[model samples]
Structures are given as C-alpha cells and as structure tokens.
Target: MKETEHSNSSILKEIAELLNEETEIVAMLKGALVKFLNGTNFETGWIFFIDAKGRSELVVHENLPEALAHKDCHYLKKGGCWCVSRYRNEELKKASNIIECQRIESAIAADVGDHAGITHHATVPLQSGQERFGVLNVASKDTVRFSEDELALLESVAFQMGSAIKRILLTKQEQEMALVKERNRLARDLHDSVNQLLFSVTLTARAGIEMTEEDTVKEMFKEIQHLTQDALTEMRALIWQLRPKGLENGLLEAIKVYAEMLGLQLHVTVSGVLQFPSRIEETLFRIAQEALNNVRRHAGVAEAALYITVTATDILLVIRDEGRGFVMDKNTKLLSIGLQSIKDRAKAVGGTADWVSEIGKGTELLIRLPY
Candidate 1:
C-alpha cells in the first residue's frame, strides 16, 4: 500500500509538471519525456507530432540510444513503424506493447549501430477526445512487454500530453491569425496615409521644377523631385513588405512584380509545378523578396536570375546576381542584414540556405526547403 501511494504521488507530480502552461510545446514535451524516463523503468522514449499535412515529425525524446540518435535522429525521423501504422489507422486506442520495435529490428538488420539492448517498446496513441495527435513510445533495455500497471501509467501520461498539445496548437493558430490581421492593418494604414503623402510630395516637387526659370533653382527643384520620387518608391516597397499584394497570383509572378517595382529585370527558369502549399508559398515568396531587395540595394546591378525546382518532398530556390560581389567574411554587412533573414526563414521551415560569392565575381544564394 505504501509503495503504491508513493508511486501515485510521483505520477501526480509529473502530471502537474506536464500540465504547466508556461513552457511551449517542444520544451514541454522534452521536459516531460525526461521526467518519465528518469522516474520510471523506461530507459528511452520519443514523441512524434503529426502535422496538418499528415507528416510525422520527431519533436522530442529523452535518453535516445546512440543508434537512434545517429545523424541527428535520422532513423527516428524517417521510416514507418507498427505503432505509427496503427496510430494512423486509429487502431492503437490504448497503451500496448509492440511485438518488436520495427525500427530497432531494421537498424539491427542494416548493422547501423548498437541498439543499447532495447528491442521492444510500448506504443501509446496520443489523443484528446477524438483528435489524434501522434505516438508516444517508451522502451527499457531488453524489455519484451510492459506490465499492466506500466501500460496504465503510459495511457494516463499520453492523455495529459495530448490535451496539452491540443492547447498549444490552438494557441499558435490564434497567435498567427492575430499577426496576419495586424500586418494587414498596418499595411492599409501606411498605404492610405504615408504612401499617399509621398506621392503628393513627388507631384509638388515636379510642379516646383516646372515653375522655376533660374537654372540653379530649377536644378534644386529637379533634385527635390528625384528624391521625392525615390521616397515614394521606398514607401511602396515598405507597404509591399507589410502586406504582399502579388502573392495572390503566385510566388513566381509575385517575385517578377516585385522585381519590376524595383526596376529590375529577372531571368527566370522553372523546373517543376508552380503550385505549392499556401504556407510554403508565402515563406518562399518572402525569402525571394528579401534576396531581390539585396540585389537591388547593394549588388550594383540591374538584373538577376531566379531558378526554381519542386519535387514531392522538397523545393530548391536559387537566386543569382552578376553584380560586384563582396568578400565572404563577417565584414560583408552591405548585404548581410537582408541575407540573414533569408537564411533564418529557410531554417524556420526545416530548410537550408547556402551563399556562394567572391569579390567582383557575382553572388549566388541557394535555398532548399522540405515541402
């Protein structure tokens, strides 16, 4: 009785930790997995998150074996297992021990590395009411099956995790919605006020140039008109950044329009389908916009090239400029500011960005995103 009470106390404490709203979804899952692995008989565990696109992502894990953690958890991140298959089919309704870990068996078959004596695991489908999220798998060294009590505990934890995940996902959706609305509002405000004001200033400066008879005064007014026209174009660029109007047509078309706005001619090449998921299209467009801005502002050139290729699982974008390029060093701040955002955005979507350049040899940016 006393041992049961002690175990119950531990479970309650861990459940409370998992229920805390302070941490984001990834951190919470990592922390909770650690607690469970340390507090129980399990030696390793991992959590997978199924996105809206039905893609399985290995979000968090604790004490993963060297074999599974190899190459940044490449094994766990890919391949299908019995647990995942059952979960996808909505057949894994409770915590149950798998006959044998399919991934572990495959690894052993391929002689990847040591399995750390982990051969079997218990699979629990993470679900809140009717909405299923993913799978929670836990294993002990040489363990063949989970006991009744262990399965019960796993079920309870999975329930808590599923609830927490639901809350976090909903919160994210709401935050993104609010951000879109706020961006649109700011874009509209700038277009209606500052944008219009700059256009008026350009017209007034032009009138000044026409009315003046003295050459010196006329030159001054002409300079004013030129500066005001630049300012108007700058304002339009800002508005476009805040709320991209060209994306409605398509990403490639949007890039062409933006390049035109900046007085740039693009040499375009395409290798695949033009359609993409909305989120991916938006991110790619933003990255392209930034790259083109760098070419316009600092490349010392009037034309650039864009290459796009798409596949079922990945998309590659290459932007090149034949302008005077800067040395690849920390001191290349002329284009670094915008280029940094291009890299960061790619990483945000599980992608990579590579830059190739040399002084006076032109610049090339290559970005690859998992579609």
Candidate 2:
C-alpha cells in the first residue's frame, strides 16, 4: 500500500512538472491534459480556442480516433459540438454536463468503427484572470469516470494554461507595435532622401529648359523624363521596403523587383542572375538595394550589370558600372555613405565588401558572405 501511494504521488508530481514547463498556454495545457488522460487510461482529450472572430476552433486534439476527429472538425465549425453554445455565450462556469444534455442521442452514440466507443465527456473552461481562453475536453468509455478530484486537477491545468496564453498574447502585441514604429521611421528616411534628390533634379532640368536653343529644349525634356522616372522607381522601392510583413515570397523576389524598378528608370541596362543563402537572403536583398541606389546616384554611366552567384558555402554579389568612376576621398559623401553602408551590412553578418574603381575607368562592388 505504501509503494502504491508513493508511485501515485510521483505520477502527480510529474504531471505538475510537465504542466509548469510549457511556455505556450494552449500547447502546455493540451499536452498535460492529453498525458493525464492517456496515463490514467482515459480514452480521449481535446483543447479548443476561442479566436478573435468569436469562433470556437480546435487548438489541439489527442487520442481521439480519426473518425471522431473528423466529426469534431465539422461540429466545431457548426453548432453540432456540445461546447458551441457555451463558448458563444461566454459561460465558463456552467455545469460540465454537455453530453448529458445532448438532444442528438442516437447520433452521439452511433458507432464510427473503432472510434465510436468514447461517449462520456467532461469540459473545463480555461480561464486566465477575468478572461477565458478556451476549453479543455476529456472523453471516456466509462460513464461518470471523472471524480471531483479529477475535475479540480483539470481546472488547475486550465488556470495555468490561461496565464501562459495571456503573457504570449501581450508579448506578440508589443512586438507588432514596435514593427509599425520602425516602418514609419524608414518611410521618413526614404521621403527625405529620394524626394529631396528628385526636387534638386527638377530644379536642374527647369534651368536647362529655359536655355534658348531647340537642342537644349530636347536635352532638358530627356533629363526631366529621366528624373521623373527615377523618383517613381524610388517611391516603389520605399513602399516595398516599408511593407513590414510576409517574407514567404523571399529575398530573391524582392531583389528582382528592385532590379526591375532600376532598369525602368535609369539609362543603365541593369540585369542580374541573383542566387543566395536561404539564411542570408534578407541581408543580400538589402545589400543589393543599397548598391543599386549608389549606382543610380554616383555612377553617371548609362550601363551597369548586377551579377549574383551562390556557391557551396558563400554567396557573391557583383554590381559593375561603366560610369564616371568615383574618387575615394574624405570629401566624397557618396562613396563614404554608399560603400560604408554595404561594408557595415556585410560585416554585421560575417561578410566582406570589395569596391574597385578609378577616376575615369569604372566601378565594381563585390560582396561575398557565408550563407
């Protein structure tokens, strides 16, 4: 009797430990409840969450035979599930007699092969402070299987679950707010840089237009068209940069968009065969954007090519320009900001940037980094 009592205490302690270890509220509760059911020889268990849209969706369901799970999905969406009305009305403290009050007696008891055996149900609402997260459900073959002690244990588990979920939700909300703030900051920078540059270009073209010659008028019109197109491209680029969501389309897609925008605006035939590390795709995308922006500004050449190659261990980017080469001098802001930005970005991710140029020849920026 002493050995049996000690073993039972150990099992209870293990269950408590398991419950305490989960960081996510729903996951931990579902795991503990499922383990409790499976360990104590119960038939099935489930966890459901009340979504923002007030829909009672299944979060986790375990040991429920395939047929029952399938049926539950249908019922979870429809009003067929026992907890539907309870969840909809926010009645957490209601009596756990969902199945006992079932109107569909024959439908509930119908045998769906091996899965039809489980009939008894006990549901406990997962409450955290004043808010209710969802419900914990357990089913058994034997009627009246849940003792008062078991009910208390289930409620305790739900309480723990609610606390964890509350913390996670708060953290996620804070993170989203921070992301919105950062996007706003980037938008301000883009407006200041691109808009200011276009304004200057507009003033230069207007001055050229006032010159009294037919050839001068044609040249000024071309300049105005080029500057206007560059401004539009810059606006598109900034919009994409500030989107702040969904990397599923990945870095290569962003790069292609950036390159296409540059090709449409600039006199250069900007083209690239870009491929890079799965892990460093974002970094590579930023690097390419910065490099191209520099090409559009300082590289007065009408022709440039961007080539990206991925190898066994590293990704390489080469942006070459047949433009008026830049002088690497302390007075040169373009060389400093543009090259330094690429260099620092590459270095931040354990990469290197090599800039090769002469006064009248051309310029080539080569970046190599581990994937």
Candidate 3:
C-alpha cells in the first residue's frame, strides 16, 4: 500500500510536468512514451492510436522490435488483447501470470516474448472521461507479473495519459478542417475580385493597341504595352492564388509560371521531391511570392534559383537571387513587415526561415519544414 501511494504521487507529478512543459506536441508525446516505457516495473511498453480509418496504429513502442511493430495491427472492434479488449470492458487492471493466463497465449506468441522470458503482462485501458482514447500495455520478463499494487499505479497514470492523447488528436483534426475551410474561402475571393478586374483591363488594352497609327501612337502604344504587362502580371498572381497545391504540382508549377513571365534567363530550378501538408504549401507559396517580389523590386540580376530538397525528412527551400544584397541592419526598418510576416508564417507551421547574402554575391533564403 505504501509503494502504491508513492507511485500514484509520482505519476501525478509526471502529469503536472507534461502539462507545464512549453514544448511542441510531438516532443511532448515522445517524452511521455519514454517515461511510460521506462517505468521501473515494466520490461516493455507500447501505445496504439486509432487512425483515420478507425484502425489502430502502433504510434509508440519501447523495446519492441521494428519487425513486430510494422507487421502487426490491432483494431478496436476486432477483440485484440492489447487495445480493443481493454477498451471494450470497464476493468482497468488486467494482469496475469504466465502459467494462469492461457487466453492471451497467442498475443504473447505473436509478440515473440516466449524466448524473452516475458511471463507477466498487464493491459490498462487509457480513457479520458467516457471517451476511449487508447491502451497502455506493459510486460515483465519475470513470472511475478503485475501485483495489485502495480496495477493501482497504472490506473493513476492512465487518466493523464488518456487526456494528453485526446487533446493532441482533437487539435490535429481541428487544424485540418480549418485549413480546408480557409482554402474554400480564398477560392471564392479570387473569383469575385481578381478575375473581374483582369478581364476589364485586358479588353481596354486590346482596344488601345488596335486603334492607333505609328507616329502619333508611339506614346499610346507604350502606355498600352505597360497596361497589358500589368494585366498579365495580375492574372498570373490570381492563378498562383488558385492553384491546387498537391504534392506533385505545387512548388514546381509556381516556379515555372514565374520563370515564364520573367523569361528563360531567370533559371528557376527545384531539387528533391516535395510532399507538403496543405498548410505548409500555402505558407511556402506566400514565401515564394515575397521572395519573387524582392527579386523584381530590389535584386538587380538576370538569374535566380529556387532549389528545394528534402534532408532527413525535412523540406529545405532555398531561394537564391544573383542580385545586389542589402545589409540586414539597415534594411530591417524598411523590410521588417515583409520579413516578419514570412518568419511568423513559417514558425506557425513548425518551420524556420533564414537569409544568407553579401553585398554583391546575391541573396539566398533557406526555409526548413517537416516533411
């Protein structure tokens, strides 16, 4: 009883620690898994989360080989011992000695624990209120298995573990839905505003070009040409705004369109495959927009390169301009808004943006994001 009380207090402290940490969700989850797995009483631990299709996926495992984790799956409704069975019933503590628990022999066999001397096991249902979140399974190589006291410790921690998982899953779902809604709203705005304005401008430019003679119309023609170019630029921007940014057709298409408009000598190139989340793609597009604006407004060079590559599951976006670069300290006052906006957008989506440039060697931007 004394040991059980101490374990309960320790678990409560862990829960408080998790709640107080200002780390990213992924890092927090990894930390939680580590603590759970390294619990003094268990030889192995695993956490299974339900995926989009309602199938259980092995999200975290400690001491379980990759071969077993990848090859097997557990479904909630299918009566799986580790995740499904625990959730179906109300019993929070299900621990058994190797000789007495014949029902779970197959699970033990599938886990390949017979040779590892994993004789004692326990499966605890992790729940937040009435919601069935997931399961935490712990095993011991010794036949002593889990005592009633140990089971009490697990029950104490289960509440905190379940709540954290529920919060993370709900947060991800809300983000995805919000992003889809925002995309729909942007589509409507582009059609209603940009499209109509560009159409009227195109008609006026065509009429001016057709009705003038060479001597008297030289200045008119120049003005008409300028209007035409402006209309084209606006049209391209609209298209960029509306482009369906899938993994295959996102950044490459944007760069290609910009290159065609700016001419072939601009030399835009993309390296490495990109598979960006929708929110990440939108931010990347905005970053590219700002970079191109800088190239056109301040960069006084003929060539620019947009190199994209993935390094260790991270997307690295490098936008380089062979133009005269300005000093950061001097330009911060003038360029603060644009630069700050870009940096904030990147950070919001778990990314970092940096710039490297000298006075004449050209400006290069590096945007790093999770892939």
For residues 169-228, write the lDDT of model 3, one tens digit per residue.
Answer: 677788878976787678677757776676666677667667766655756766766876
In model 2, what are the clashing residue pairs, if there are any? none
Q: What is the lDDT, from 0 to 100, of the residue 190 in candidate 2?
A: 71
lDDT of 1 by residue, 227-252 (tens): 88888777888888888987887788
Clashing pairs in 1: none
Name the candidate, 1 or 3, with the larger TM-score value.
1
Give stretches of model 3 more than 4 Å off. 1-164, 212-221, 224-228, 242-254, 258-286, 330-335
Off by over 4 Å in 1: 1-13, 50-55, 65-80, 88-91, 106-116, 129-132, 330-335
lDDT tens digits, residues 214-309, model 2?
A: 986868677786767667677857666675233467565566556666662322322343454443776777787787777767777545676767
Two-way lDDT contest, 2 vs 3, winner: 2
Better structure of 1 and 3 per lDDT: 1
TM-score (C-alpha) between model 3 and the true structure: 0.52
lDDT of 3 at 295: 74
Error in Å for residue 227 of model 2:
4.3
How far is 183's C-alpha from truth in model 1 (Å)? 1.7
Angstrom error of the Cα, residue 67, model 3: value is 36
